[model samples]
Target chain A: MRNLYLFFRKHYFIFLFLLLEVVSLIFFFRHNKFQNAVMYDWTSAISGRVNNTYNSIAEYLYLRRTNFILGEENAKLHARMPQAIYLADTQIYIRNDTIMQSEYRFINAKVISNTTNRRNNYMMINKGIMHGIEPHMGIIAGDKIVGQVVSVSRHFSWIMSVLHKEVKISAKFLKNNQLVSVEWHGGDYQIGVVKEIPKHLIVSAGDSIITSGNSEIFPEGILVGTIKQVKEHQDENFNTATICFLTDFNGLGYIEVVLDMFKEEKTNLKASFQEL
Target chain B: MTNLVSRNIVRFFFLILFQVLILNHINLGGYTNPYIYVYFILLLPFATPRWLLLILAFIMGLSIDLFSNTPGLNAAATVLMAFFRPFVIRAVSNIPEEELGIQPSMRILGFKWFLSYATILVLIHNFALFYLEIFRFAEFFQTLLRVILSAVFTLGLILLSELMFYGRSKK
Candidate 1:
């Protein structure tokens, strides 16, 4: 027994080193598999408070640029307002439109912390569960798709940025409405690759890409990016194209979390079909 | 002794904030991400207990991970760096018995000794961090490029901060 004790005492440092490394590796793999919400919440709570305090002071530095972008967005919104439009036909009556019910609600949030250099990047926003944010909700800045909410705490939420390797955004070309998925392959945050494009389709540079709205998360017609180049893929039947993202991910400050009101109903209906 | 403990406590928070707040935002050309937080592990006093060193390194790396939303990437790398630190110091510097407990810094250890020490450890930390982050050998050359570029930038910041902050102090 004493020999065993002496062995441990002699190589205690090695044991400790191995123990710590194992623990950290476990955390890494487990986090990748299924995020431990309890531990994530605890850490995010502390880091969120610090980032909030820092953002308050640092936000003033970008006041001019933020205001400029806000003004442009405001102008775009103002143009769509009912008050700004003048009907040419006097016989046309404007009544309560029941056919066009609001399906998506937008919750404004401030991005407290963000990154673009990492292979799998994430962003933290000021809004959380308290502010009507939930996992799987899409985030957009102005009209550009940003990312999806992966997890939420009481006062903060984590967003898996579109730059993440595993993130695949369902998008379609505006010209032909051909569906393709967009993905980031770990280089150049400003660009993303459009995959699964049919080889026969006529894809040219400068074609606009927008969300397909096939998914419950993001509504249709959200701007994704503009195509920059088309390259033949390894598969003969498909091709891939590179696109320059419209949203300036690096300069993201103010964003809106999209709350799909009928998401639960839609998912439930689909789940029923899958049971067969 | 109390002074050393308190000083490290202050440095712990300061370096974490500086790293996640300022250094993280500096993505020069999308290739270099200078992580200066490893300076905390690098600057730990030579006589620090082995267990304490590992624990401190873990906490520091985890704190950075929390802020960056990377759960364990930094923590694993920093622990590996801490594990290799004593050997790195032994190989680079021939310290006298009287100064065994002295903190590793440019002011005390001289620039050449500190440079090699910081470089090897920073490279180790960055290499582990970037590789684990990608978690694959598919983009080996690209990841290697990022590792080397980031290591050079991190080393520059470490040496610059050491010269600026500790250069004036005689102790």
Candidate 2:
């Protein structure tokens, strides 16, 4: 007993170092991403303040640029709105009210903090549960899809940005509406991969890609990106290609979340199907 | 004792702010990222208790990690750096063990010694950080190149800061 105590005393420093290292490594190697959970949640209170201050100071510098982008988006929206509408088929009736019939509504929010350099990137936004924000809510910038809300606190939410390695945006070829997925390869923020496209499909370099409505998270026709290059996969039947995003992720300031009213029903139906 | 604690507290916030706000946003050429925050661990007092050093290093790295949203990568890497710090000190500087709180600085360790010390530990820290971040041996050479490049940038920043602040603040 005396010898054991003396030996431990002599090597106490080593033990402490080893203990801390192991704990850190455990968190690193843990299959669950704990750093994005509790510790980060605790910091939301602080970083939200810091990032807000920094962004407000820096916001004035880019007034002209932001105004230009916002003007362009407004012009595009103005041209796209349904200016001519007819009360088609007087006999046909819709159950929901005219204003509330749409399953999704846009919730405007400002990005407080964002990053595009990491293997897996995430963004923080100013909206949260109090603002009707929740996890898995689809986010977009103007007409371009950005990311989805991953976790939400009372006043803040973390967006798993499209540049993140683990994020897979359900997208499709705009030309044919063929279903596909957009995935980040971790090197560049502007480039991502279009997964599960058929080899038979003629995917040219500049072909536009947009979100597929198959995924409950994002609505159909949300502009994802355009193909930059197409390459044949190891399986000759399938094709994978690189896509360049339409929205400049590094320039994110304002974004909107899709508050989908039918998300619960869709998820429940999918779950029921999965049980088979 | 109080002086040392207070000084480190200030340094802690300063380094984190510089790292997240400035160095992180640099994103040179879209590949190499300079991480100067590891300087917190690098400049810790030589005779400081190992347990405290390790915990402090973890907390410091974790703080930066939380802000950057990289999760545990920095915490793991800085912990590893803390584990190797004592040996690195012994191999580089033979300072007496009686000194309780003489923090590392270019003026005390000399420019040449301080440069080597910071370079070696920064290399180790970056190695652990970038590798664990990608977590794949398939891109070994690519990861190695990034590690070296980021280490060089981090070393340059550390040396520049040392030159600017090291001698001016001493009693």
Task: State which candidate has the highest TM-score.
Answer: 1
**Colliding pairs, model 1:** none
lDDT tens readout by residue for model 1, B38-148: 999988887899889999999988888878877777999999999999888889878774674468878777889889999999999999999998898988998898999
Candidate 2 residues lying further than 4 Å off, grouped into runs, are: A26-41, A82-100, A233-235, B1-5, B93-101, B169-171
lDDT of each: 0.88, 0.82
- How does candidate 2 fare on TM-score? 0.89
Tens-digit lDDT string for candidate 2 (B22-110): 77767765766899888888877766788888899889888887777665679889988888888888788666655423778888667
Enumerate clash totals for all models, in the order shown: 0, 0
- Taken in order, the candidates have interface RMSDs of 1.2, 2.2
Query: Which candidate number would show the highest lDDT if scored against the true structure?
Result: 1
Off by over 4 Å in 1: A32-36, A86-98, B94-101, B165-171
